[model samples]
Target: MKQIQRFFLVSLTALLLTVFTGTWPTIFKAVARSSNPVYVAQSLNDLAPILQQLPTSVRDRLTTFISGDELYRQGDAEGAAAFYRQVKPDFEVSDTQILEPIYEAEALSPESLADWQQAQLALDDDDEAGAIEALQSLVDREPAFIPAPVQLAELLMEEDEEDEAIAVLEEAATLHPYSTEIIMAQVETLADEKEYLEASIAAREFALLNLDHPQAPEFQALADEYFEKFSKRRRRRSIFGAIGNLAAGILTGDRVPWESWNSAVETAELVELMLASESEFGASLAAEYREQLPLVEDPDVVDYVTQLGLEVAQLMGRDFDYEFYVVQDSVMNAFALPGGKIFVNSGLILGANSQAELAGVLAHEAAHSVLSHGIQSFFRDDMLSQFADEVPLGEFATGLLSLQYSRNQERQADILGTRVLATAGYAADGLRNFMATLVAMTESAPPEYLSSHPNSESRVAYLEEMIQRNGYNRYALEGVDKHLAIQAKLS
Candidate 1:
């Protein structure tokens, strides 16, 4: 037992000697086996001097780089730029040699080029701050390289680091105002960020200065268009300031006002009580029963609706491929979907007498598409989803009593469509006459679908008033069925 104890003491002494002598391979292997607090505390104490020796600027740069990298990785480009620029580099080891006295002696060597290439690689890897730091090092070594600042500015712009990008570009532009590409890029960025007024001023300045250049004419034309659009938008906003407040609750992200919510409830209750429930569709049935629905594939029928659609769009001053689809349902309906998709029910077609009358209804729905009214109307209602079992149907169909667009919205579309149809070389008579026919139908055989879009005697008269004022409109719409070659054989 005494021999065993002596042998253990000798082995313990040897281990302590190995640890104290800094033979870390053996010590570390042993440490890999246990958590020893004394060694950890001693190790940290030894690092204190090393930590103190690091330059404050280098420390700051490292901290900032790490934090900014986190932000950049998270897709917060603007935020990352903010953190990155806080770095104040401390590189006291730079050469004491001044280049002014010995220009070629101090000119950038291949080593400097290698550094530039390194920065470029970091940029290519999507590490903007890393690239900036690398490029900045090259810039410090060779202070006159134009590529460094310009490239940094461009990368910053792409990352939406607008303010920082602008600061860099502005300085570069001061030196090279003739670079149209750089100037235009900055202007585009400003415009996309909704700094339109500033962009317009910059565009005007560029246009005026470059008037003698070949591209100046193009720039001037674009500047003039921007000026006109912004000018008109400003005037419109000024005119509708009061109306903006009244309806803004529904248009913006703010909470819906109590008054608006109450109005919605009241309107819904009114619709629930008074709206027809698909029972008032007899006139539509008669119109369809007397005449077999015109085939959608009928060349004459397609040609007729397309011509009217084009005529209507022209009047509205919108350039769109106007199309009319025959849904074939004997429902008194017409709808405008996104991207000029217009559907007119065969029932609405047979219900009308004159080609002009049918043209009016088609034109009105076309106006809805052009003015984006249908999209806006959708945003205002039906933001709900309900289903029963596997089938989907509304408890109350929407068309029966849509609170007809506010009279103002209706009047706006009417005046706009009237002008469009008249300008497109189509007679406004179709629009007016159709409204009048609908009025007559309203009195004689009111279709359930017509309730929400109740015929206004005043509206038909209003179209006539516009025609008399605009003076017997004369425009012709030209359309050809480019798809007639593709109609599948029907039995």
Candidate 2:
């Protein structure tokens, strides 16, 4: 009985030691030697999931680590440490790597090692003013630091300080001109402000400057298209809307579209956009505007729409001193002005549910600005007197723009509108939903959007495809939820 007890105790001690400091292969061999089926199955289950995602190189490294860990488990701490120290793989400077922890440990080799990290910490601290100041300095000094200037621009822009943000970006642009980011920032900001007559020309000039480069063709086309579109919209409004509004006013003593020549009717509309956007440094000029039409004026509705308007306005560029006028009309009419001025009819204001419907309006107006519709309108009407009665555009030039856009221009604005809403973290789907509702509503009632927009269905469909292609998650209003509730206090 004493011999049996001693033998059993010896067997238990050996089993426990085997479990402590050996590789899996060795441990399993020992277990197999002991004929233990359950331990092998348990080990396989533990490793299977982790092994599945491993690439070949990772799997190789993992095999070594697993071996070391197993050895440690079996009680050979020194041996385990030796194996772990030997297991790491060497990555060369140019090695294209996956996003594993090991790979991220060695990405972009930029200067200013701690500056960006510190900047991020400052940003997360919610001291946006301080964050902007610090980041602006870092960007000015390094210029090569991508994250700092971009974040700085975004932060300042959000705080309604476009001029400062634009200045910071301009400095960054000097270092990274060909970088898509810098170029887009400079050109896109100008476009957003309705500096189009100039902006379009500038966009073209930028393309010309880079003509020998890869992006030249696309940029050139965008610039030219913007210029020509503005020229034509101005021309079209001059021709059709000119006598149309004046005659309507004369024909009906009602407050007509254009009260008198005090405005030029066509050109003044464009000019109005410019004047409105004047306060917002980068958001002024003869840009296009579009938004839902309100049937009546309510301060509560105006407040809601203005909040949304300001949100989208900042996304287009920066410098947003804008106003939301509650026009008491029901034609679903809204328009944009240069210098951050927005005119919203009561009809349009009350009609918007989400920001997209408003975005649709804003983007359209932005397109107008980008194309320089106002300045070009002056050119078109030749109030400078370049042509006669048929408004200079007449039957001949109308064939070019045709008082409606070719599918390309309409699609471009819709695509851009979708992008604008998405960038602002607004619900882009709201535009699509608004379109569907409008279409359905139009079936039952008169459709104001179509008479003006003409391509509502296609625009909505395109927006849908865009959101899917870009994989934009619907907007998260958690940041604005409280604001929305407080505004709800108005009602």
Candidate 3:
């Protein structure tokens, strides 16, 4: 068994290397003939990072090569032939490096290219109807021609046919699941229609589809934004549902079950409900997390941490009870679980320079809970359940390591966290300073902050904007001596 596993690993590695070094046709054939083609496809897709880091010309050539293979698989023999013939003459490939100047290669066949160019010309001429007709015809002829569907969908939107546009994009997504443009259009259109649940799901699927793409971080940020918006909508619905349940109970002369609403459920209450067969999900999972994660033992330290968290929560006008735990780990990390369970790593606490700094971090985690990030994490439509079940925990961990908040959610957190810090009588600079430090930390070692957060520069800039726009006091609270005392306890 061990030998077989070792052989599989070696073969997969070789196949991945061939995907980079060999000609397009050879790599395509190899992937097509593989026992587990999906695995082969993913392994090659992992080359996105390396492909992105290459020179622009090289990346373009690689894209052309892949496009050629895609055309071939779609039965466009002439297009495939053109790409194959052009590869060697345009550039000399020596040891996986392009050795000479290369002419631009065609990713589309001559015939299709001419049609697509004509459609573009029509659109430029303010001939929306003509552009739509041409692009629609082009897509009808070649459903796999990704550009046609994207253009057609855009033109459809211009004609105030958003539903039809979404349909066109959806079909294109099915055919060209890896087409970034198509997936993006579908998600944006869904969002524009306030179909946030569908938009969030689409964004997440796109992120998973192109996990290593150069724009993957952007995709994740989009997903986070969608999920956050969906959560807000869900919260509103839950509030209404609770109200309805209350009215129904009064009329029926029965006790209202407030927990029946789709609001966040407390772990203890959920466990009891499950024991009584009143909950759908197992309470054991929640208990497992609470029991397995190591917690700080010192009463004074725990009390102080809880006090600080409550102060921030109160500042945000959150009336619900919040539980804060200090995890006895060395990683500079913190996270919020469902139902207001927030965990702060001891390392994070020790590394803080001031109470305000610590407060900023705490406030940010609180925002995740407040924003319903944990709830969104488990949300699945029937379409996604099968895919979700197939993914291994280890594979899932990679996505989580980048941190789960979308770019929008992160921005919201940064904005709200700054407000919470200021409202709680702390300097607003605390979060900004922490983010700046994190940006630097990313260069030396992977910190927990980066694990599920967006790129630091954007985060820091937006945070600074919020602080300046709000005119929050940057030098309000230091609590340096008090922070040092907390550090002393841990030391």
Please give the lDDT score at residue 139 for candidate 3.
Answer: 75
Task: TM-score each candidate.
Answer: 0.35, 0.38, 0.46
Candidate 1 pairs with clashing backbones: 315-420, 316-420, 356-430, 425-475, 425-476, 426-475
Runs in model 3 deviating more than 4 A are 1-286, 380-403
Query: Whose lDDT is greatest here?
Result: 3
Computed on alpha carbons, the lDDT of every model, listed in order, comes to 0.47, 0.48, 0.59
How do the residues 307-359 of candidate 3 rate in per-residue lDDT, one tens digit apiece?
A: 98888866543334577889898788887754456778888886565577789
lDDT of 1 by residue, 356-429 (tens): 45666776776665544443343345322121111111322333124345443455456655655555543356
lDDT for residue 328 in candidate 3, whole number 0-100:
91
Q: Model 2 misses residue 126 by how many Å?
A: 66
Worst 10-residue lDDT window, candidate 1: 482-491
What does the lDDT come to for candidate 2? 0.48
Error of 1 at 355 (Å): 2.7
